[model samples]
Target: MFEAMIDPTAGPSATAAGPPRAGRPERLDGLVVGLVANPKKNAEPFLDAVGELLAAEHGTAGVVRTRKTSITDPIPPATLDELVRRCDVVLIGVGDCGSCSAAAVADGIAFEGAGVPAAVICTDAFRVSADAMARLQGSPGYAYVTTAHPLAPLDADAVRERARLALPELVELLTSAVPVAAR
Candidate 1:
């Protein structure tokens, strides 16, 4: 497939290696959850579940969850800029689809360049083996979830409701999710 052909190239890494390394500012107090949902049947479910999961994982700091307008296209520049300005971390849903995965990676790069610290690009766990997922996770740069663990395996209504309830927690987790290695 074309995705297999396009080298991952470590799309986005955690902040930067080592101590604050000068230039970049320290992490932020509040974090905005950037949910890059691919336009797909399952995108809503995955994103909703992620919002809920993050909230449950963290707390209410800040959140800016959104979905891509199109599955084939990268996020709009304005949206990307706004996401960077408003969020410290981002999570892109791979939705068990290759095209969605690629779009997530692209969006991640844009967010990273905008100064977002960590970007979690979710991929299909079933499609890619656990070992491959681990390799992607261990890659020099970029934060990845290759396990194909969809945040929402259940119904969309349940996922969205759950996300709404956990929005606060998600915001908190995004701030705390800083890679310990970076610190």
Candidate 2:
């Protein structure tokens, strides 16, 4: 007779996809924009570029901008609250701030608690190099994830052009789960 061995440590393997989510799908709408920047200087440039693209290409209704002063720090709760209150959708640019970008995903979750649609923007390198960055970072808290391929070394014009090309997809993805009128 043989008995199956039971390992106490045996369980489901940890995955990069992070957590499982289930809920009613939401729809996108034209409302307000929440622009977030990482601690890097280029973050602002990226945010500005996306904002312009969203406005010009997507016809975003309004705009709100916020940036984290330090990469190690979370976006301030007060600021997140303001963003939740002010905007229907938020576009958060992580730049090269990979870890900080992950944390920002958590911040987006916090904003979602207050009812705001949010997206975290990062260079494709980070997403492609570490596909788990968004997955492991994103929890049930955030609205969605938007990965953008930035021009190498953070070229402003290139980023702007890329934003123009990608903003529509980001807008559609971010707001896909949450309606503009809900907030």
Candidate 3:
């Protein structure tokens, strides 16, 4: 008897549909930075440190922060709308795990589609997941920042250090007209 085989590693059924990515600002100075934290361990402090760095080093006017209710889901439409309305540039992250990493990338793509430049932050361990998510969202080769892995166990100072390490790439994503694909 002969048997048929199936391939399970196919891509997503549909890619994301929307307008092109938003135009990046020339600089972060005087721009309102938005922070969207997923429901992951240590996400808030990580993003808070990033926000502080943006303010001190890049001269961002202020920051508006929010938390998503789920780690494996896209940002709620209302929250997305609010961020787009209020922020000039946004950072979404702390994607330390598989599901959260995908969701965070999706959120970043959504913001980009809505005319807001976005930088997504994730752990090094989840880069594959983040890349797959970006491709699925029709943003193949999209750029995002990654810090060292195992973010959940880090203390406040360590998390801040990770944020500090990721700041340059984050700044580049928000301020440059050219998109730097993730390596």
Alpha carbon lDDT of each predicted model: 0.51, 0.57, 0.86
lDDT of 3 by residue, 1-183 (tens): 212211113454464453377898898999999999987889999999999998999899999999987787678889999999999999999899988888888888889989999999999999988888877666788889888889999999999998998999999888888887784
* Model 1, span 136-170: residue lDDT tens: 43333333444334543646675566455434433
lDDT of each residue in 1-183, candidate 2, tens digit only = 213221212332364233432222244336688888866756777778877766776676768887777654557778887887788777776645455555555555455545665666656555431233333443423334444544346577776676676666676656454432211
TM per prediction:
0.57, 0.68, 0.90
By lDDT, is 1 or 2 better?
A: 2
C-alpha lDDT of candidate 3 relative to the true structure: 0.86
Point out where model 1 deviates above 4 Å.
1-29, 125-141, 149-183
Better-scoring candidate (TM-score), 1 or 2: 2
Ranking by lDDT: 3, 2, 1
- Clashes by residue pair, model 2: 26-177, 109-141
Model 2 ranges off by over 4 Å:
1-30, 128-152, 178-183
Which candidate leads in lDDT? 3
